[model samples]
Target: MFSERRERLRERCSGAGVDAALVSAPANVRWLTGVPGAEALLLERDRALIAVAHPARDRDEAIEELVVPPGQDPAVAVATAAHAELLGVEEHDLTVARHRAVTDAAHCRLRDLHHAVEQLRVVKDDQELACLRIAAEIADQALGELLESILVGRSERHLAMELERRMVDHGADGPAFPVRVGAGDHSGRARHLPGDRRVEEGDFLTVSLGACYRGYRSSATRTFVVGLAPQDWQVELHGIVFAAQRAARETLAVGTSLDDCARAAGRVLEARGYPPELDEGVGHGVGLDVEEEPRPGALEPWPGEFGKLENRVPVTVGLGVALPGRGGVRIEDTLVVRPSEDGGPELLTITTKELLAL
Candidate 1:
């Protein structure tokens, strides 16, 4: 599985006129070599070598021991062994002290391979998609269990902690991001930190979370009324946010631009007379990192601005409505962009979108 990825990276190196490239980014190294330790890959024209603190091993075999002098840098040893003319390293991932040592050992010009591997990872292949799907399933299961339990009077921090524990119990390596549990007036704040605020009967409860499975992550969010009956405004706000989220999800496709998706949700919110006050991006790419590439919306635009969506790129569509003192609602899901002919977008997070009274 990883051999193909390494070959593709090698081809990229050759095309970029780099005689040899070193991958040190943990995610990039895992993607290439399937080794889940502190490791680096040295890619040359005709061969590739992986250097690790521990000995290397075949992807399908047990690790083999190697002899190395104490206190020697694995990267320097790999560079020397490969006999590279020009050593390309990920400047962003490598530390200044490490970079200096690598340059001193190589005795060759060091080039920055900035985000080259990340750019390659933006598009998901079959195996990556499968991992993400499992991640979503784990998150959904955890959330489902949370809803089944009595939520009244529990502190937001406690709930968040419980969700994380449940995700870990359900085969997740860990929580993808901080579990967000906003109660009462705290609901709908983007990236809201969970506090000690206790859940109240009349408050609106919003929870946003995800699970990491096999290094891939998926996210989902839902809002519910904490009491026996919701106020009319709560219902109205939830309905509006739900419609906006649905519109955004429906508009996601391979050819759709990031701006278009944001606009689609924005138009719904605007039409409902509750446009977002703080203009955070509506959604973003998800993979190895909780948030990655292809950020959506005019808000928080990247250096090149929101780019076009590509097929097989997984992203989250999150729409939030924060109504000051009255709290708010947020609904989100992770989806894979696909061609319209192939059934539009593939929704990975399948938790129910309906607002429920907890």
Candidate 2:
């Protein structure tokens, strides 16, 4: 798989009119070489070279490894050793100083590799999907365990810490990202910092979390009322978010435009009298990085540029609304885009989307 990936990258470099390419992004490096922590990968037409500070614990013998001496930049060393007239570098990842150093050390002209590796990673193979499935399972298990315990008096910080610990206990490398626990007025915010605010009766509690397993990640979010029965407004809000998320998920088919998916969900929220400004897109591709490519509503490379969803790509559809004084609701899930004949999108996060009254 690693060799195949390198060959594809070489093809891309050739098409870009470069003789060789240097990949320095950690996620890109791992995706191409299956060796984590590699500082850089220099891909030639017939050979591949990796530079690192120390030998990897599990090494791949197909590529030649170069151990950098103390205080040496691995990227510079790789560039110095490349035997090509035109070399492609990940321009977005390399610092200006580092790029200057690499240029000074290299005997070749440099070209931007721009997001080539990231674009290649948008689709997943069977092994990658298996890893993502396990990651989602771990997240679900951790959240399920947390729900069974008492939560009324728990502080947001305590809940966040506990959820992260629980994910680790259930066989995860770590929380994919920091576990988010929002209570009362803090609930439903896109990204919240856990604080001393304790969950109170009738308060809305939103928890967003994911687990990283074998380099893949899964994200999920759920909101619950802290009392025996949820308020009418709470139920209504949860229903709107839930319906919006479902609409987005349903729009995820092979060749479906990414903007259309976001619009499907946004229209629902707008119809419910929420603000017309749906900042975060309905979802985005997820893999080695929690959020990678094929992003809807992304501002980078310019907005409305996320082309379309392809089959076998894992993505997350997350949407929510936050009222200033009153709490709100968020519903998110990780799923793999698939053709309708293949049962549509395969939902990795299986936690119930119901408005649970704790």
Candidate 3:
């Protein structure tokens, strides 16, 4: 798998007028070679060479490495060692100082490796998908365990900590991101930080979390009502967000434009009198990085730049709106974009979307 990735990256480098690529981005380095750590530089040649300033554990020994001297730049060492003439460098990732040092040391014409590795990593192979599926399952188990516990009087921070511990117990390397617990008026606010706010009766509760397994990450979030039954407003808000999320998920056909999918959900909230200004476009790509490419609200590269959905790519369809001083609802799921012939998009984080009243 790593060899295939390196070959494809080299092919791209050749097309971009370069014979060699100096990949300094950690994530890109991992994609090209299995080693994961900082300050590792990759030089693509007849064989890829990794230069590490410090020791990094390599279980597979799949790629060769050059350990750098105390003060020598790894990028310069790798690039110069490869004797590259025209070389591709991660323009966005490499600092200006590093690029200049590499340019001076290697004396090579540097071509921008414009997010090449990210483009490659965006689509998941079957093994990657299997890992992500396990990631989702771990998160689901953690959240499921949290749901089964007593909830009255617990602080958001405690719940958040408990969820993270549960994910680890269920076999995640760690939480994909920080576990978010929001209550009452804080419920549904996107990316709310857990605090001393305690769970109380008649409060809306939201929990957003994910688990990472074998370097793959998946995200899932849910909001539920506290106590015997949810108040009317809680039910109404949950239903609106639920409908919006469903609209977005239903739009997840292979090859469909992502812009249409974002619009589908946004249009629903708009019709229901949800504030249009709070519209953060539906969702994003998920894998090695929790939020990678295909993020709807981020930059659009070109005309019709909104990317088309692809099979085997996993993404999170998260949508929520918060009215200040009032609790909100956020519903998210990590799903693989598969064709309907394959039973539509396979929902990986399935923990019942129905708004639950505890």
Please name the candidate that would achieve the greatest lDDT relative to the true structure. 2
lDDT string for model 1 (1-358, tens) is: 6767777877787777778887877788777767766367777766667666655444434222233455876676676665678778999888899999888877788898867787778899998999999999999999999999999889999999999999999999999998999999999777789999999998999999999998898988989888788999998999998998888889888778756777888888888887544356668889988887777554332355347788999999887898888789999999999998889899999989887888
lDDT of 2 by residue, 1-358 (tens): 9999999999888998999998988889888988776888999998889998888787787988999987998899998889999899988899999999999888779999878899889899999999999999999999999999999889999999999999999999999999999999999988899999999999999999999998888999999999899989998999998898889889989988667888999888889888746678777889988988877745344343457788999999888988899979988999999999999999999999999888
All candidates: TM-score: 0.89, 0.95, 0.92
Winner on lDDT between 2 and 3 is 2
Model 3 CA deviation exceeding 4 Å by range: 53-62, 68-80, 301-306
Tell me the lDDT of model 2 at 79: 88
Name the better of 1 and 2 by TM-score: 2
Candidate structures ordered by lDDT, highest first: 2, 3, 1
Q: In model 1, which residue pairs have backbone atoms overlapping below 3 Å?
A: none
Once superposed on the true structure, which residue ranges of model 1 sit more than 4 Å away at CA? 51-82, 276-278, 297-306
Ten contiguous residues with the weakest lDDT in model 1: 58-67
What are the candidates' C-alpha RMSDs? Answer: 3.1, 1.8, 2.3
Q: Candidate 3, residues 1-358: lDDT per residue as tens digits?
A: 8888888988888888788888887667876776765355555557778887666665446567787887877777777776677888888888999889888877768888888788888788988999999999999999998898888799999999999999999999899999999998898888799999999998889999999898888899899888998878888888898998899899998888556778888889899998655356778889888887776645543344458888888988988877789878889999999999999999999898898988
Order of models, best TM-score first: 2, 3, 1
Task: Give Cα distance to truth, residue 84, candidate 3, Å.
Answer: 1.0
